[model samples]
Target: MRVRHSTNLTRNGLTDWIVQRVSAVILAAYTLFIMAFFMCSVDVTYASWTGLFSNLWVKVFTLLTVFSIVAHAWIGMWTVFTDYVKSTAVRAFLQIGLFVILFFYFFTAVLAVWAV
Candidate 1:
């Protein structure tokens, strides 16, 4: 007999696995890029920091990094919640709370990166 697995979030095991890996790569690349940028800069001034993010490409990359972070967190948290939290009510509450917090963070990053 084949065991069927289902999730309310529409992501299957394969999709979730792929998403997690892709997001991880993006996160790693973004971190390295940021570190390199900081390392190469001689003067770490507020103006220089702001100037780096003022570029269109940098803003877009930052948004993508924010998205990758949220996606990675969601998948990891979802797996943990499903695996360890046995109570339906408790799991649902935690999942909802996690989503709310993640969404808020994503939106905040967007506003911060794009605001002139």
Candidate 2:
């Protein structure tokens, strides 16, 4: 016999899935942009790096990339934990720990990008 889940998908879960897919698409485009930038700038000087980061559009795109990555990671990890971790206490602890680490990493990346 097949069984069904007790709980239906929550709004948060649906939103997360949508965000993850959207971000993945955006990241693919960003990858192409990076490749084109690298190919065009053969010299790879400090000025080239500064010029890329100094642009407002580049900065905004980078920030969106960072946010998307973090959201993707969080949603992916949460799914893993929910699926694989059986113990409630352990799951809760690991979820919180993962979230903290993800937040710190995202924050650091944002700060580094801003500082550039």
Worst 10 residues of 2 by lDDT: 1-10
Q: Write the per-residue lDDT of candidate 2 for residues 1-116, one digit (tens) a residue.
A: 22223221234667778888998988888899989999998798989989889998998898888888877777787778778877767877887898789789888988888893
Range of the 10 consecutive residues with the lowest summed lDDT in candidate 1: 1-10
Model 1 lDDT per residue over 1-116, tens place? 23224433344888888888998998999999999999999988999999898889999989998999998898898888888888878888998899999989999999899887
Query: Which candidate number has the best lDDT?
Result: 1
Give the distance in Å from residue 95's predicted Cα in candidate 2 to where it truly belongs: 1.1
Global lDDT scores for all candidate models? 0.85, 0.78
